[model samples]
Target: MKNIGQRLLEERRRLGYSQQYLARAGGVSAHEQRQYEQGEDLPRADYLAQLAAHGVDVVYVVTGKRSTVINISRDQAQTLMDNRVVGQEVTLDGPPEEDLYFKLSDPSGPPPDQS
Candidate 1:
């Protein structure tokens, strides 16, 4: 398993954010930021909260795994954020939409009659 610092550094680089930028955004001294990324010291809870506020996934920070709950098509995601998605019940809190739409592609392709 990767260390916390390594994971944090990976996420930072993945977002194309510089250490200095993250430090400022996360409200920590540059030296502290370097240390955190170097495994010298762990950031306090408040600092972690700051990073999360800036869109850094706290689960990824601690467990190095993606645990985001939201999942939607890029277009749908934007639409939901824009307060749309009315009448899109499947996309809401319910069974997966795939269950409902799966038959459309095979409307006349169901199994042969068992007469």
Candidate 2:
């Protein structure tokens, strides 16, 4: 089995995320992230949970075979799809459901009203 550090390093590289950037996203210091990636240390459970939220499964990071299960219920998947909007914020007239269209927003960047 590959080491946890090696797996994390590979995944991070695959995602094109630098240690500093990932650290910021995971709410850790860059130095700590580097240490974990370099096989010099392991993060705490809370840190691992944060990584899992970012799509890094702890079992895969540990054993390198993706032994973790990624089971999203139908309702959860629908909720996720319903909430997702690219390059814009959405406001719904009611709860998320089928035929839920989005209200595109500016994303608060770039020139306004260019679309």
Candidate 3:
């Protein structure tokens, strides 16, 4: 299995960010970022959260597990369909009947009475 540092490096490279850029974004020094990529050190929780905000897959970087939730805006989804990036058409309205990678809970309890 790959180490967390290796995963962090991969994610940084995937985003085309330099060590300095990533460090600045994560509110750390470039040296620290280098150390993280080299597996010499681990980032703090706040730094990890910063990385997530910058679109880094923090969960994958730490635990090597990809998140099941796939967040895409309606416009982005429409664009994917227009470009044939997705083969199947999807409706954003209502809960999906089938199981998906992530499940949405009914947060409001139950619907109001029709009567």
Would you estimate the TM-scores of all the predictions? 0.60, 0.56, 0.64
Model 3 lDDT, residue 54, Cα: 84
Model 3 lowest lDDT segment of ten: 96-105
Sort by lDDT, top down from the best: 3, 1, 2
lDDT (CA) for every model shown? 0.73, 0.71, 0.82
Candidate 3: stretches off by over 4 Å:
74-115
lDDT (tens digit, per residue) of candidate 1 on 1-115: 8888888898788788899988998899999999999999997888888887566766788987775444355556445545755555433344444221111234568788899
Put down candidate 2 lDDT per residue, 1-115, tens digits, no spaces: 5677888888788778888877887788999999988889987778877876666666777666654364554566556656776556544354444433233444686675856
Give Cα distance to truth, residue 63, candidate 1, Å. Answer: 1.3
Among these predictions, the greatest TM-score belongs to 3
Instruction: Give lDDT tens digits, candidate 3, residues 49-90.
Output: 999878898889999986556666566655655676556765
lDDT of 3: 0.82
Q: Residue 58: error of model 3 in Å?
A: 0.5
Backbone clashes counted, model 2? 0
TM-score (C-alpha) between model 3 and the true structure: 0.64
